[model samples]
Target: MACRVLEYLILPLVGAKTLIVGAKSVNYMKKNASTALRVRWSGSIRGGYSSNHGSRFYFTFDRAPCTGPAGIEAVDWTGASRNYHQHIEFEGLCNNIPAGHMQIGFNVGTLPGISWQPYLGWTTSGKPKITAEEVDLGENKGMCPHHTVFNVKQHTLATADTDSGIYGASAFRYTKLAPDTSLRVRWFGALGAKSQSPAPGCLRFYFTFNGEECKSPTPIDGAIAWLTDPIIQTRTTHSSQGDYAVALNVGQCLFGNLNQMDPDPHVNDVSRIIVEEVRLGKSQFAEQAVLLTCSFESSSICGFTQSTNDDFNWTRRSGGTSSSYTGPSSAYSGSYYMYIETSSPRVLGDTAVLYTPNLNLAGGCGRLVFRYHAYGSSLGYLRVKLYNGQHMTQQLWAYSGYSKNTWQETNVYFKQGGNFQIAFEGVRGRGVTGDIAIDAVAVFNVSSSYCNSPNRDLPKAAQQVFNLRHWNWYNLNFTGLGEIKSMIYPKISSTSGLRVSMTATVMTSQRLGPCTQWQFRFGGHVCPVPTHSVEGSRYTYSYQTTTQHLFPITVSGICTGLPAENLVLSIHTSSCGGSPAVDAVTGWQTSFFVSAEEVVLP
Candidate 1:
């Protein structure tokens, strides 16, 4: 058998503007950011040999795992921190020879791209053969998703089956990607931590990358995945064997481990999930995505009019209220998206109401109560009072500002059925009132189980479902300059602005390479501003890409302006002469927050 241990490094190269990438050789890392904790590790098996049922490779980190490919070290595998990485290739192995009879192979780790799969194989008379047929790849063993071949970059990898094991060989072909194209993007996923057992099928995965909260230096509170089950396919059907189908359960919840499963399995038990090879089928590739928007068409207009009581005469509604988009009163069918902000200072005897129609349709699951989003602290939390009229209030739910700006989705099932309603009324502080955008009000079986279990993606950790949203785009064009609306909830501290200023990530096309001539163009620049008027809060950014770095080129910029206006974020012609500049953020006052490593597309 022939095997080769190959590896690639995701170096956290310094940015022209700024960069916080860690060492390429690190395995486990723990650092205290401004307001949040940042931990990164390597889940891939350090390029190596074929072990038996007994021999294995292992590792561990001091802190938990972060998202995507992080750094890895060779030490963290001793005692207390018990994590192990193994390579069980039963096919056959030759001494570590580049061109011998037996060959062993492994990828360093993956980068942000969709095309290309990696594996181990052998070569001889110009003919290559595959091995390792008996490993149960479908099962969730020690191996995880990143180790599988299916997770390789889609551009250069293809799925090919052999008599023994499956492999996605790099067709030894070099095809140039569309310049300024992002190889991998946040097209699909549920946010936050999730479970892997008793499988819940497909977890809600989101696509758009909102800016995260920046504490002091590094940006905190962005997409940090709770990884598990990096399994790869061996034969047919969806049956998991050794480590196939690395299952990731998605839910609508918070980012913390304790925030999802009470005991927090993800927080304690596992840190990372890595698998080996994956064959990218068109269908699998297509289905590997998250939705761009939330639905609010079937909203149950469940709030008391300001007509109730006397004195303050404010509306009695406390939960799931909205100002943006349309209220439930607008549409009797289809879908709608709206935001509900909170009004403060507390008014007594102020009961809220949710209006709903019988619709008289059969197979009705009941009023799908969807609170687009909410803000404030635990004490100042927005409480949703769901009622079936008779039982009056069936639930008193709170959407905290802890998971601020992030969109959370949960389907509420009505108990007494018939025409129902969902209302919000704050007892302390100002009652929940703002553009709590509510949409995709679906009519499903109102489930009151209160999953509380967040998904591996962002959709599950959110307290309010900000549907009709977007994902981290590949090669995207911003919709021009627009206002970025803040979520009803905010993570406020004197140090960090309950928010991080956002910039656009455009995908531009320009030929680049080892010989491509380029220089920094600094002087010729125009600027726009936000209405909030917070000076010195923004930063400008730009980059250079080669033929290797395609689209999905993320561009990150800081802001010096808040409450400013008409901020036009455009890509300039690089000194290398690239074509067409695409906008990243429509410049809308987005409800979500994001701070990412911006890569200028090829």
Candidate 2:
């Protein structure tokens, strides 16, 4: 037997009508007698059952707007009640043996206007139960707003047990506001549930607005014996063209109780699913555009500079220019290709160079890509070098000898900062048959290192050495003792060690004997043995009698976490028999090279 109850509240004096449509019923009333009759409607459903049973309720009303009850506005489900024409609410209870279930829900037809909000509430007893709160009915049309229902129920078993029992209840309502000039949506709702069982239990809540699903439902899973935190979610979506949708989901899981003696171990499990808040708004996506793009197909070198040496230069040549050239007739992609070639009787040392305009690489790593063609019996060598300044250069790529007659693409990576140029040099070989060509050069900054890699040739133990930190090549005549402090070497913050190498040549103008001694000290410490004695002599009649003695020493020490500072080298000289002078000749006559390198220990 089933127990069902129906209740109605009507105000006939206000031109109101009450009707029951299917399992759901609605009561409608006009705001006033003078103005166009605006009907106010509310829907509800109640039922009690045992075993497997479920039911759905629906309510509908004409497209009419009426102000809600003055005193009841603030207490309405949506908090701030407005003029609405339709609302729906439902509740249900289940009583049976271990295997029993019940479900109830309310649905309504579509209504006019875009302003609408839905509220939800749910409660349950015991654990180890699975439940889904809401589902999408259909699309939203102007007629009656699509109907979305909220429902809650408990699972049951086949056998009856006095200790096994389950019950659930839920309610919800919705209202629409005045339509906005732009596309937008605002929705709010509250739903809750609970279960207790040894097996896992789950619950889910769904919401939809403006014909689109907002976000997926939030799910809660239950443990063997655990309680979940209250779940409250809110969402808002806005669009300039009313082309958006909003939705929410809530779920919970309740694990079965192992200690329970009852056949239905889940009878002792407990859980809850609640949606305390839900909101939806509107939004639009912004537009975007590319900043720049370059392709050398139009004969535009893209700001690359070309230079030649000894009348040998890279010139743009079309296909079929010569018989020995069997590569692409045009550029790698465009209709023109830049190539360097020697005359029939080529000069062995003739050279040609191509340079790219200064490029900014401070952003990070950068890539230089180009296609080259090198064929024929006597192929000249081609090399790519990076030039930071007039004297600082790094070779990036090099190639020589014959290759496939087809174009081969090459990519070069560099990490140096600031403006720098890339140059390609082609050297003439023994025969005039050598011909080289390049095309499609591109240089661009990259977020990641394209060329930075460990030096495989350097032993692992030596890879920690930093670049040449400080160095000084001195060429000055020293007649007596002299202290030489090399230039100040700035140690980077990460420097852990320093390596120093010094070489000095002593040239005596007159006769030299073993009595002359020279001492070299680094950082206040003697580099080698304290004094090195010179014992030989060279007599030159035309020039000053010159006898040279070479002193070379290499040493390293820990920096001890010191700040960047200068390193000084002191040279002491003494003559026991005759004066020995430190020669300072511009060329190779006399020279002192002192260099220091910073090292980071592993």
Tell me each candidate's RMSD, in Å, in order.
22.3, 38.3
The true-versus-predicted C-alpha distance at residue 386 of model 2, in Å, is 0.6
- My TM-score estimates for the predictions, one after another, are 0.28, 0.29
Residue 90 CA error for candidate 1 (Å)?
26
Runs with alpha carbons beyond 4 Å of true place in candidate 2: 1-300, 308-311, 325-327, 451-602
Q: Judged by lDDT against the true structure, how good is candidate 2?
A: 0.34
Q: State residue 403's C-alpha deviation in candidate 2, in Å.
A: 1.6
lDDT per model vs. reference: 0.23, 0.34
- The residue-by-residue lDDT of candidate 2 on 1-602, one tens digit each, is 00111111221111122222232223333222222111111221111121121121221222221112110000111112111111121111222111112122123221122222322111110011111111111222331111111111111112112221221221222222213221111111122223334433333232344433333221111111111111112222222322222333322212222232221211121112111111111101000111112233455565666663444667677663464544445655546777777656558868887777776676656656577888777777889988885544689899998567788877555676787888888887777667788875666554342344464212212223333432324334355434534355543322234444333333323343322333334455543221111111211111213322221111122223222334454444443333343442111112244444444433
On the 0 to 100 scale, the lDDT of residue 282 in model 1 is: 14
